[model samples]
Target: MTPPVIETRALAIGHGRQPLGRDIAFSLAAGEVLCLLGPNGSGKTTFFRTLLGLLPVLAGEVRVCGEAVAGWSRAAFARQVGYVPQAHAGVFPFTVAEVVLMGRLARIGRFSAPSRQDRDIAADCLDMLGILPLHDRVYTAISGGERQLVLIARALAQQPALLVMDEPTASLDFGNQIRVLDHIGRLRGQGMAVLMSTHQPEHALRVADRIALFNAGQVIADGPPAAMITPARLASLYGVSESAVSASLSPLLSPERNVLP
Candidate 1:
């Protein structure tokens, strides 16, 4: 069998002298979208940091693209994994295209400017995300939804095998949330492995090929969205009354042809 693009074996994710959650064991195959669902402070962010190699692994191991992450250089890792943070403070006045082109810095090498090919790739990424029209606009002047799209395009410009997004639609309106999730679903269809953390189970059920529910520093459930996101499971995971959980999911459980995977 082909090895997964990302694998964590008994992985312990944490920050300075503090372990976030339990040891995690999971693998993400190419073309799969794995959604990490948990409430705030449930170690979701810590887990993402660990996966991106931003946080130290207190125990276990994390392997990316069939090699230990620690064994690979930072540049090599960046080339393979594209990460989009939850929020970005845009202090500079760079154009959207310029921000997106920064994704190619790892490939461009230090002290070297981007070449024609790099610009072409950046443009292609913007086009792929349907944001090419905004390439010339100032990033800080765009709407929040547009900024999110720019960030996603930037990640895509890296041409990574895996895309990791913390909260792709944290504070967006309903329409923007659907737009972002739809774009991510398309990325998975294009053979990119995607892992996103979300507070909404309905979002996961709609787009994720697999779902991993995190609680108290460990994954309590990991499986297909249909199997793992039932009312009973959600109630247990959220520590809520079972009836309340069922009531809240009525809309999701209703018949809908466009239901999430």
Candidate 2:
């Protein structure tokens, strides 16, 4: 049997000597979309950072392709995992194409310039994200929605087997948010495993195969969207009243309305 694309066993995460989270056990298979939903300060980003080897794992392990992540070299890790951080303003004015092409660095030689093939891949990624027309635009000049799409395109340019996105739709207009979710569905259909974090349970319902709810610095629940996103569970996760969660989500959770309001 094939091993999971990414897995964590008794994983713990933290900053310096302070532990932010622990017992993050999970596995993601190819073509699956696993979404992490949680309140702010619940260690979602810290878990991501630890998985990407940016911070030290306070305990336990992160594995990719059934091997410990610490055993993989940085280049090997980059080739296997593409990361899409929340979109932010760029200080430099690199063209969108140039920004996407940066993802190709892991595959290129140390001293080589981007070849025609690299350019083609970057263009394809841009086109895939429906922002091909923005290829030559200055990254710093695009709207936030456009910039988010550009960042996704950049991660896709890596052509990695797994994509880890942190709040891919945060701060976007409603239309752009839907667009990002639609593209995520498409990417999963094309057989890339996706692990993403989101503040919105509605977004998980739209695209995720499995949902993980984080609270108190750990995943409190993990299962199908329908099973994991109930009013009671969401109330506990976000410190809201169950009736409030039910009322606010009634329109969203109704069988007739699959689309977010």
Candidate 1 local lDDT, 103-212, one digit each (tens)? 99888987999999999999998887678999889999998778888898899889899999998888677876887788888888899999999888888888899999
lDDT of model 2 at position 157: 89
Q: Compute the lDDT of residue 17 as modeled in candidate 2.
A: 89
Mark the regions of model 2 whose C-alpha exceeds 4 Å error after superposition. Answer: none
| RMSD in angstroms between candidate 2 and the native structure over all alpha carbons | 1.6
| Cand. 2 TM to true fold | 0.95
Collision pairs in model 2: none
In lDDT terms, how accurate is model 2? 0.89
What local lDDT score does residue 133 receive in model 1, on the 0 to 100 scale? 96
Question: How would you encode candidate 2's per-residue C-alpha lDDT over 208-257 as one tens digit per residue?
Answer: 99999987678888899889989989998899999999988898877796
Our tally of clashes for model 1 stands at 3
Compared with the true structure, all predictions reach lDDT values of 0.87, 0.89
